[model samples]
Target: MDKAKEIFKVTKKTLLLIAGLVWSFAGFRVFTIGLEDIINYRGNKFISILVGSVVFYIFFKFIFLKMYKKHFIRITTSGLDKQYFFQFFDLKSYFIMGFMITLGILVRASRIFNPVGVANFYIGLGFALFLSGVLFFISFSNTKKIKVQ
Candidate 1:
């Protein structure tokens, strides 16, 4: 059983790549949903897009970038030669992600806020996530280069 589980082990670089792919995919999905919502909104589309852009800038600079740096450091500093595929994110990260996802779902479903506002927020968040994924890919490349040296 142990040996079987070992087959699922992956290098840190691979983990980084996986993380990038997952985040990018999720970002794309969320972004599209937001775009669709904005398109259907009766309010001003330009304002919605603008709000989204601002949200993206703020979230990326203030939140996602910091998170990327922290996670990148953690991945690079791990002592293990091989880690489980899902180990790209620590347990705390997984829990936080779960909580955020649940919260987002609940908020969207409750419809207490305006749909246009939600769409703008989603757009901003999605862009930040996609950029964060790009950062992970860059880190993966740099780590590969270091290993080759």
Candidate 2:
């Protein structure tokens, strides 16, 4: 029974990871198209990343604070030997989340202004968010002795 439960948990988590990848890939292509049309200046890209971080942070507040806060406490205490916690949610994750969210939101908002790149951005952002959820699960699994999700 325990084996079956473990198998089910792994399967569910794997499915979520795969789903996240597929959604993000599809959305990113659409976002690229939207950016080509709406982004008049390169500076907007950086601003978008910062905005994405805040957006992603807000979106996951519940899980981050309520469910996974203890993991963070452990990581901070674990020191360098267990630094994978830091690595799992490393700089790359943040930048990717930022870029994807920015592009997706830009796409959605541009619908009002009728920019060429606007629609794709929203689709992409939605998918990027899906991926972020998967990453959260992955990060959590890595830090905890048992599957917390």
Q: What are the Cα lDDT values of the candidates?
A: 0.85, 0.45
Q: Candidate 1: RMSD over Cα atoms?
A: 2.1
lDDT of 1 by residue, 26-138 (tens): 78877887889998888788899889999999989998898888887777677777778898788988898899889889989999998788889999999898989998888
Candidate 2: which pairs clash? 34-117, 104-121, 104-125, 107-118
lDDT of 1 at 9: 92
| Regions of model 1 farther than 4 Å from truth | 145-149
User: What is the per-residue lDDT of model 2 for residues 23-103, given as tens digits with 9 covering 90 to 100?
Assistant: 446445654654554465445665555554554456446433332344333333443332321233346545865786686
Query: On a 0 to 1 TM-score scale, where does candidate 1 land against the true structure?
Result: 0.92
**Model 1 alpha-carbon miss at residue 11, Å:** 0.4
Worst 10 residues of 2 by lDDT: 79-88
Best prediction by TM-score:
1
**Per-residue lDDT value at 145 in model 1:** 32
Model 2 TM-score, all chains together: 0.33
